[model samples]
Target: MIAKIMGVLNVTPDSFSDGGQHFDIADAIQKAQCLIDQGADIIDIGGESTRPDAKPVSFKDELVRVIPVIKTLAETTDVPISIDTSKPEVMLQAVESGASMINDVCALRVNGALETASELGVDVCLMHMQGVPKNMQLSPVYDEVIEDIKHFFAGRIEACISAGISESKLILDPGFGFGKTYEHNLEILRCFDEFKSFGLPLLAGMSRKTMIGQMLGDRDVSTRVTGSVAGAIIAVQNGADIVRVHDVEETKDGLMVLGSVS
Candidate 1:
């Protein structure tokens, strides 16, 4: 099993979770080191906000927000850094600045993003998100979530392969809450095993999301730790290769127990 933990390292001051906490360079570096010590196999650094109905950040703003942080983290840790961006320029700059992976929400459809990641020789994770960030959850509709996302992944993977991206340098993520309704999210989560048809490592990122909040009806994000770990465990049991999470210590402990009992 490709068991691994991806720590959320947000450089944005407005992220849905842990925002503004790491906006300071010193704080971000400390948090990065702390996460590494806490057992994060990978550190995913993102500068932009992809929360529901979020506004877009400019390229210059994103670069300024992320480059220094990426450089700092890269120099300070041996863990691989994945740039969570959809912009081609951002990917190019991020990879050049030390990001070893491209964890795009848009799956490289933003013009030159595909070409850039293909040339960078780093890992790329193609994800399935319905619609754009600004309006994805605006009464989104799907005839069938599983089949639709599978099609999206197939097309994106084919495009990446055709664009000269290596086969071994790719991963897949079924973006859980990006554009899904409460029922849609749960359905996708429960039927996650159906995604195995794609034949690629799956990444699960359902930590502290709206779906969980809506599931429990009245839990705050901070208090959603149990729900998040439960979702992560379900994802693992369903065939996830990696899980991107925020509650690193709890998630690690949960996985250890799950492994032991298995």
Candidate 2:
């Protein structure tokens, strides 16, 4: 499969690495330009932190954080802009502002999220998370992890289809570490190819996540870039169609040398 490189633009004060870093619109725009110059195929922008144990923000606060950046990125970048949110209102406003994609970690379960996506007919990414960000990893379990994830995706796909969204407009993310132990994350990583059965693009966003931190015993997110690239490469080699990353230039360089990837 042809791999899509989704550059991440975290516009939150609490996102794991870029927390409070790109909260400003100017910084966010510059970063988006840099990502585009680095060969990012899409820019996935997130307003919420979604970090485990993180406090939830209000709708106005989230809207304040994301809308400007999405508006600017949509206008400036040739690459498609994806608003990474579960809020239906945010999705609507983002699309109106020129976003071409919706990357919802909650799989559009939030009331009206699916409807907004279907109504807009924009590209949507449906992800698998066991629970909300604040407490997801508190104690996540599964009869079988991969099966459980695939099942979740299956149900989400059905919901999207029922809402009149076509299969080609959807992409699936296994939600690594969103509500998983490092072991659970590794299990998904080890057998990532199994997700190919879904017959859609598979997006693996492991950049600076807890899985790599746990594996290397490094809690610092900045240092995890290499580890993230390694995971992305492995996932792509296995069956991933997209690698959502924070480090655009590095990931682009690494993927090019993989030789087998196209």
Q: In model 2, where do residues sit more than 4 Å from their true spots? A: 260-262
lDDT of 2 by residue, 1-262 (tens): 2478999998899887788888998998898899999999999888888888888777788889889988887777678899999998889988899889999989999998888899999989898999898889899989999999988989999999999999999999999988888889999999999999989989999998978887778667778988888998999988998899999888988888885545
How many residue pairs in model 1 have overlapping backbones?
0
TM-score of each: 0.97, 0.96
Model 2 TM-score is: 0.96
lDDT of each: 0.88, 0.89
Q: Against the true structure, whose TM-score is highest?
A: 1
